[model samples]
Target: MTEQNEEKPRNFHEMELDDRILKAIAKLGWQNPTLIQERAIPLLLEGKDVLVRARTGSGKTAAFAIPVIQKILNIKQTARHQEIKALILAPSKELCHQICGVIKDLTIKCSQEVRCVDVAPQVDLSVQKPLLVERPDIVVGTPTRVLKHVKAGYLDLKKSLELLVIDEADLVFSFGYENEVKELMGSLPNIYQAILASATLSEDVKSLKSLVLHNPVTLKLEEPEIAPESQLTHYHLMAEEMDKATIIYALLKLHLIRGKTIIFVNTVDKCYKIKLYLEQFGIPTCVLNSELPAKIRCHSVTQFNQGIYDIIVASDEKALEEPGNYGEKDNTEAKKSKRKKDKESGVSRGIDFQHVANVINFDFPLDAQSYIHRAGRTARGNNHGSVLSFVSIKEKPLLEKVENRLKTGDNDSIFKANHFKLEEVEAFKYRAKDAWRAVTKIAVREARLKEIKQEIFNCQKLKSYFEDNPTDLQVLRHDKALHTVRVQQHLSDVPEYIVPPTLKGMGGLTKRNKRKHDFRSAQSSASRFQARKSNPLLSMDFEGFSKKKKKKN
Candidate 1:
């Protein structure tokens, strides 16, 4: 076994690596080993169980990937048919894909055949089962999905599995996968090596040491103290709830944050609302939330990475939820379900947005941990980034909690608090208000139109009426056109009406339209109808009047 105190290699070239892997390293432009890589790679290559604590973008992926690829290559050279030798579990589909990509890239120059498969919830089990049957040498996936296959016999992990790597171990535990991870560890052969890597070593992760890791060499890399403090500057601006959106717009325009920027909100509704509000300023933005389809979410992230859009409004809603039982069974007696739903999408953990220039917490985070994760998205690996938070007056305590978390007794806290005067943002507030009204009106109108269309589709009588009388269809089309034109007009001018039709009369109408229809008259008419129903004399008089009129004639 390699000694942890041995002198570290200066660069990848000096390390004992296959020539092909060295070539791949050169291709990747990795001239020297990062601090974590220097400390971890050698230990991993020595066939030792290692636990690494490092931050994002510390070259942790390559540290494990290179050694794993080398091991897979050596195994492939000996056998004609490859079996599942290595399994890497990540917390999310995005991270799984990312890890698989890195592995594939590193193995590109290997002489022996090294096949990798990404088993994620997004991929159908039917598709994955066949791929597993083909016996890929490397499997990267989330815990629940991977465990499901192993338990069902689609994936054979008992015989040939040589390595189990749990990337983001803290996150795995945080995501409530401790039971699944323990089950997996128990199922794997006793001879295989395991490596766990994470940023923060919480109590939950420390507890896992007894279960999965065996005499693991722990490597805690000391980060270099860059001059002039951290690469991230944190700021908090105090504003009212209504002024937050305006302040965000003002800050973006004021600071000219046109580079790849992420605005993190608390809820899914806020995600789309912020996106729409920003769009009203002619700033093209994309949204990422748990409710978006998997394909769209993937595409959005890809495009953001490719610089298709400059801004992404994302929600931390899913991240804030307690990770539930992600496709685990209650007991052996319970019948097995065929498929399980994928974990909810979130931007908090294990997501690396490269070159993120700015992160704005459009809403204050739930707690200190949430704040830390949100800030982690930026200022990664010596890169300079800025975090601006919108804090309402009532959220001062939450802000203080975040500040106290980041405070080292000797140094100033990370957050620089500031106040915005009403006079300073007054004009911008009006403009933002107009934009907000316009955007919200448009959104409401579009949603109402969808509901109307669905209602029409479901109404058999309406369908028959439209089919029989094509003129009614034309009238409906004409109404749609008129409504669209009205919406366009509302974009330029103040909207006369903002409420959706479904919600129109439940409350009183707006004051401007109160004169158009007299509520008093309608109330009086209703009262008269009720009075007539209650009065037997009125009914008797009507019958007597009819009889007397007939007699007189």
Candidate 2:
């Protein structure tokens, strides 16, 4: 195998090619072909199928795209836009749009041989037809939507389809769209060349390889090992559910970190909660998730891409697939079920961030693969990045397991986030150093509030129990815990509403500050309600107040 590869082409430039394609490559300012690009491009240009297994941010897009461009340029494409000669299917809308951007950038330097139409899930295909008909080269889209067009007879797959490129093959299969993918693949011409690429290959990818590829060149780009002298480090804090926010606050205040930080949470509620907490502390930040309106999500990503925001809090999966309420179903079990379905379907893959210099794991992933995906969001594309995790004592065991999976014994962590000054969370304040700290505190308080509410529910049951069976110590203990949680919740949630003339120890924050704080607290809940609307994260249930009120009424 070594001798065979030694005889193969050494670089993309060495491959048999045209001056137009060569000029297009140089015009794009590509320094050199990556390993995958170098190994796969020749086979691809020779009209042979190819399969690529590599890490994210390894330039797999270009590895396949360059050859697709060469093929389109080599072919005699008519001026008519009704026929799409090449179809590039991506697992997510972001990846599809991102791939289209790369093609567009390259097409600018090419001899007008390529034009791409991006068909996404939410986009109207009829509206797309006019634009698509004007460009007769390539069609890039997510699977289901593109398949719908193919099935509906809107897309001419049989006549014009010359190449079928499945980017993120593993993601597509994982999303549970294998049946649809297979159906779509069967619909395409048998003579067409097939290309598959993925960050990781699983059983589904293996099956697809056997089904689709023929005499394919296989390329694998291993993740470069962390150098002994590298500055990037990993660490997790053992935190109580309540202490997470406080830890985040402490990390932010040290002011050593800044420049496009990314905070990863498991759910969208956490994303909004963290953002709200940071913004309250005067941190200029934004969020990226499927729940955000399409226009707003695009605008936010555009701004983040433009370096307009300092921090972006999002779910790891949201960064990969189409933005939608996949993980936020009303039924917890149903949500988990759907997430499992999506995972099996391949829609819930991961994404990489180009500018994210720091990644904070507010919620630990369920497994080692998830942990790697979360951390890989940073340190992308040869750039050094840092990862910080907040894990409670209960979660530490799982963190240890993940660490072992990464094959490293124990990576060093700066326990004092303040000491390292890793990031300034107040991105908008221009000087708000502890933005993440404030957000983290808010997250802690919000959690405390939820615990209090649950306790209140349990206490109400106990109150009913005591009315019938009084003097139960178990119920009594639960009652005490309930009251304690409520008091803490009031202190955290209604800080401005509660007047602490003297804290547990510190005499006072100051008489003037105290009065201002009281006035602020008084206005906070009402203003917060107005600002947040009906969000379950911010809206308090009042613990069966409606039932009691109805009884009184």
Question: Which candidate should be chosen as best, given lDDT against the real structure?
Answer: 1
Whole-model Cα lDDT per candidate? 0.65, 0.57
Candidate 2 accuracy as lDDT: 0.57
Candidate 2 lDDT at 418 equals 16
Tens digit of lDDT per residue, candidate 1, span 461-517? Answer: 465676678565433211012122113222222122433232344333344543332
Q: What lDDT score goes with residue 547 in model 2? A: 25
What TM-score, computed on C-alpha atoms, does each candidate reach? 0.73, 0.68
RMSD from true fold, candidate 2:
16.8
Where does candidate 1 clash, by residue pair?
Answer: none
lDDT tens string, model 2, 1-553? 1113555446555886666667767876676776677777877888888788766656788888888887877675434343578999887766776778778866776645677888863656786767665655888887887888877667768777889899888777766678888888767887889999987778888888887887776776454433111434465555664456644543343222444567777665565566555544333445555543333344345555554454677765533233223223323533453322223111124343555567678876655666666666665554555667778665666676666666543563322221211122222222222333444544654644543455445545555676677545222221112121112122222222122221223222334344333322444334433322222111011112112221110
**TM-score of candidate 2 against the unseen true structure:** 0.68
